[model samples]
Target: MNDIWLTTGETATLLGVSRQHVVDLCDRGELVCTKAGTHRRIRRSEVQRLFNPQLTREQEKSLWLHRALMGHLMLDPQKVLQMATENITRWKPKHRADGIAMRSLEQWEQVLSGGVDVVVDVLTGLDEVSSDLRQNSPFAGVLSDVERRQALRSFREHWDHEHTAA
Candidate 1:
């Protein structure tokens, strides 16, 4: 099943979208695929992601931290941007040989350049790209030490509550 590839129609059926919509996703680069003669073949895992946007526990924790950063950004957009720019510059060399991280870094650079609204969107977004961006976030130390600890504490408590209830 790991190597399985689905046609546009098959992918559409799994996602409950039209075949053309699947094609549109591929064309938009939201989904990656390879051409099989005249048709596109998408990976099963890719379709699964469309169905499940839920982040892992670590990613969830990171998102919680970024949410705190989001609030800080609103209060001091320029300072937050400066911090991100510095982090990006400092981290870029470390990820130079890593294609995915480099791309994520590039996107972060573009988002920072786009201004406060763009950065907010990425910080709060639950989309695949957003999740990926959060994983490679250059906004480290944007929140004060106390703020970071408080945010993580709250997240952990809530996460534990949810899992325990389940």
Candidate 2:
């Protein structure tokens, strides 16, 4: 199962590019592949590595946490809310600033318990909060953006690998 191999066409389709593009990538040594008689055969892992590269241990853990949180949000909102509240409480003290009140946990619980619409509102409100904080906390903003991108990239890689393997 882990030894899945894809032809150039299949690789191109998975990568959302042209077959010639995949060929070019292989030729340029950007994508690893082996020749199967006349055609090129690329290992699924190689293709995935080309798209996702590698992440540090902390980045990997953060991606796993993000995926688990998203799964919980979809399957068990109550559990997600509970976990989020606990996490907020644990991290609030570390992030406490002069004007920042530790009131978000209460508000988060309220919105999470309200319904889907309220959850959406909470997400929107969090975006605004992040923006406001970003202005004063440039390091936090950079770290957050990097974490978010890594989480999303890892999630997409897992999703694509799962479906493609299936």
Count of residue pairs whose backbone atoms collide, per candidate: 0, 0
Residue range 1-166, candidate 1, lDDT tens digits: 2458999999999888999999999999989999989999998988887767777898888888898887778898999899999998988898766588888888899999999988889898878778889999998888889988899899999799875654
How would you encode candidate 2's per-residue C-alpha lDDT over 1-166 as one tens digit per residue? 2359999999999999999999998998878899979899999998887566554443444435344345446676666566655665666677655435445544554555587555534332223442232222211222246666776777668656754544
The TM-scores, one per candidate, come to 0.69, 0.34
Off by over 4 Å in 1: 1-23, 26-52
**TM-score for candidate 2:** 0.34
Please give the range of 10 consecutive residues that has the lowest summed lDDT in model 2.
Answer: 134-143
Model 1 poorest 10 in a row by lDDT: 157-166
C-alpha-based local distance difference test score of model 1 = 0.87
